[model samples]
Target: MKVLSDAGVNYIRIRLWVDPYNAAGQSYGGGIDDEATVLQIAKDAKKYGMKVLIGLHYSDFWADPATQIIPKQWKGLSDEDLNTEVYLYTKKLVNDFKQAGVTIDMAQLGNEITKGMLGVRMGNGDINVWKNEPYDTKLTNLLKSASQAFRESSKDTQLAVHIETPNMYNYDLIMNSLKTHCMDYDVLASSYYPFWGWGGNNPDNIANIEKMAKDKYGKKFVIAETGWPFTLQNSDGTPNNISYDPGHYQVGPQGQVDEMSAMYKAILSNDNGLGAFYWELAWIPVKAGWDNWQYNKLMGDVAGTGWASITSRGYYPDSKIMYEGKSASGGTSWDNNTLFDDQGHPLQLLMMYKGFLNGYESPANVTSSADIRVTKIFNNDNVNLVNPLKINDQLNVSDFLSDSGQEYLNGITGTKISDASLKAIFNDLQDRKQSKTYTDKDGNKYHYEFWLDGQTTAEKLNNFLKLNSGMKYGETLKVNYTATLVKDKEVPTVTSPVHVTLNKVYGLNNVTIDSPLTVGESMLAEDLANVQKAVNNVLTGAQGTTISGETFKNLQKAIPGVYNATGALEGIKVYTTDTGNHYIYEYWLTTDDIQGANKDVKFGDPINVTYSASLKWVKTA
Candidate 1:
């Protein structure tokens, strides 16, 4: 918090989880932002003279558009009970912070409450919980309760209703739904990521959304979370969520800086635009521990020294809260997007932000000029060199002539060359030095300087002719010159690519065999062969075939008995016999690990198959 505050960051947003502890009272491993953690963070932010924005997840774990699971204790409650639970929970949380001398400057009612929060999974099947309620009663009730609770807790703290896809292609459906039902928010916050957000490549649409929210909804517009990755390589061995596409935005530090500048400009363009917050600016990578490979010898082995031992606290049997253990073999996915690198070193973007705050402007446009002079080169021994070569007269130059020299000669001779083509040739010439040479019909050699020696074409031609032969009978030559001045200028547009490695698969859904199998039955040898064949087909499919998280899910769906499939670090472990390493490596892919809001894969990407599993039949009463 102090690091950010010193770096000109004025606001710090902290997410709070409700009852992150399991039934055994063991806390979840991912920061477990309970009351104590929230209080300490708020207090630290206050000490650092930074405003605080507290985000309520209203779940024991991460909450977003796809998953908004209800807290364990709050499940099966009636509408009235749920409303009361929400009100009391929010009110107490805010009041507790107030009593701890940490005044909340802003509060997000719910984190990315796009599909409605407090979702309860019915039985073991997927069902629409919101559809069960009439007129969005449950959603509005929960929002009203949470909002009223915040108001009752503190009158000064501003309230914001957050959504993930306001500027997305489905803006009307989301915003209209919210406006029709719930409209008690002081700030309308939206998440905008250039690589992930809807129409993110187009800044005008985002600005228009900001203006629309302000003008139509009468609410202050703020970009709640936005980030771009410098590298696509995930710290964990899995593929990165965000990838760089040349058609859209550039990648790396300069790309990040430029994107930030453009976003800031767009935000400030609107009248009621408050400001933008960079999401997870301080989430640097830590040493490997539990689920991390640096300290642990194997997955789920917590009884080891170093970072693993420290991370083992959450999974200890005697511990109050027992966190579900994960293999500590991977690293943070957002480390590349953070303000600091893995070594705690500040990145170039940190200083760029400082410069932005200090009112530094981007570089100015550059303008330059060049003189092009053409000299008619002829042989003094030739009788046809009377009036020198006139305009539109073909020079019959050698095929070895430089393109720029040819184009310049073409331009001087009244031959039409499009401005675009001329500019392209000029730009290429300006990029580097070039040389051109020509010989007359009399066997005398004449050299012309297109760019080398910094001499004009006419000067080089004249100097060669004057030094070799001056008005001689058989060697004398008449030189005719035409001075062509060209001017060029540009506003200095720059671009770069941020490369990200991705694990892609193809034909993942083609797993089928001759025999039918039961869901709970053990897999036969033929089934395994079919699975291998399907995977091999994907491996040997079109070279550039790419897959997405949805595709992985569909692959699971295609195989009747197979529960899941994922990319492995070692790739297809069964294809060791193939000397060419043709096997596609993969592991069991989960929704939590795949690209949540980002785009899909590209062509020719090799996939990693880590794990695949078939379901086992269970006897139930």
Candidate 2:
């Protein structure tokens, strides 16, 4: 926690629940995450010279997007009564913290409030929508009451409305809610999980989200809680253990340093972003598994047996890294696709993970004992395909007799298919079994099908969208396909050339070159407008929609690229001008502070390109 404070994290968030322990007074889990625990944590943070941001869960344990059960104590309260209780509880809690000398820097009225902070409740004769509970009156009253309580309790403390977003698509809902609630939050709080960003970790998607949040919500925002596990003890190679707390308590850790490092880089590089807060610091690897800290350290409870050597400070101890090197399950198991034979020996599989720099190869120690193998052979690797049982044929969906297939004989509706159609479809499937193509009885042929190696749902959808418009049997769709085999692989580099041209000159002072000036945003605006006008002109003339795509592609090819030469890779942005010259070229180069270079570029500088007249330049701005 102090490390977090030293890293410029000013506020510490503590979630409060009405009752988080058992009836017999036994502690539940997540050590003192209850109200009393929260109070103490707040005081401790204050002692360390850090500010506190108290989060009121209003539930006994946890309340999130799925579970927002009202606290048992607040069960029978009417909405009106609930509003009053909230006000009083909030005020009392703030006052208690203040009196205890733990001044709150901010207060989150609720947590991840994409849905109503308090769930729907019954009133008068109908279910209360919160906004429409008492016919719109009580809803406003409830929000106003909560906001008023926070404001009146501490005038200097900022009120933050918290929401979780591991992706960009759900932000519209959050923005709409903030406006609906008329929330006067000083900062926007978000929870980010890169795994959730693109159904799996995707750095490009992460970049898109950073751009989206900063561009959409101009207010200061912080990654309220984001952490990745460091251990692999569950499915998908994640560490998820629920046994520690018997019934209600649960815990796990999976993507640790790699994920954390990525997020750290993102926050630091973001233009309108604050830092992040790793959730539940105590639950971190250093404090779990054993009672005696020394024993835990020795047995590797906090350090795990894997961390016996090394300083135990730089990311992980030597034991952890060495253990990972020896254990097959150490590194992410999701990357393992090497097939094994009946004898449990490794076989090269059709799918192979080609490391970024090295040639794809199976581990030297990996082996398979299976016999009677066939290889599908993806890319360079001639990996073996095998079934543990003696199976001569492929157990594909097509193998199930079409006549007896569930789709042909609809079990749900009991609809029957004609024999002729079944026979034709079966023949089609048999004919094209080698290729992935499928055809229906109607003789409609769907071309070009490829087996997708295991990928996230989001990746599958993106692949389908990029390659073809639709997916179904007997649907002829023109498509292009691009896919990556391994998880967390970087996208292939893409660089395209840009062409610049100059047309007629404008005035003496403000040189009106014929070339399109795709400079700042204003130039983009003018370019878009003129490009549409050119398209409209073409449509009104002889050229039809046949060449519209090509025309548009050419027109937009010369977009400006911003070069950040100082960075490892240059930052390139492309822009297009409207009606510029064709062959005649104009050159302009702009720069900003190139260290140790002769040229000193500042905010704005004039760079020009000169060309001769008699240029019959078509309207290309």
Best by TM-score: 1
Alpha-carbon runs more than 4 Å astray in model 1: 120-135, 168-173, 197-201, 234-239, 243-247, 288-330, 355-358, 361-621
Q: For model 1, where is the 10-residue window of minimal lDDT?
A: 494-503
The window of 10 residues in a row where model 2 has the poorest summed lDDT is 366-375
Q: Please give, for residues 1-621, the per-residue lDDT of candidate 2 as tens digits.
A: 454454344667787776654454533233335666888888778867777777777666556655566665677889889889878877887788778777778777667654555654344223323344343444345556767877888888876666675555555545544566675666667776554444523445555655665677655666677644332332222133321222111122112434544565665566766655656433323223221222223233222222122222222223333344532112112111112221222222211212211233333221111111122323312322121212132334433234323232221122233344333333332211223333434443332223332255445345434443322333322212221122122223322112222333222242344343333312233333332343333223221112233332332232222121111111122222333422222222222111212222121221121221221223344
Off by over 4 Å in 2: 1-10, 22-27, 121-143, 167-169, 197-218, 233-255, 268-271, 284-621
TM-score computed on alpha carbons, candidate 1: 0.52
Each prediction's Cα lDDT score?
A: 0.53, 0.42
| TM-score list, all predictions | 0.52, 0.40
lDDT agreement of model 2 with the native: 0.42
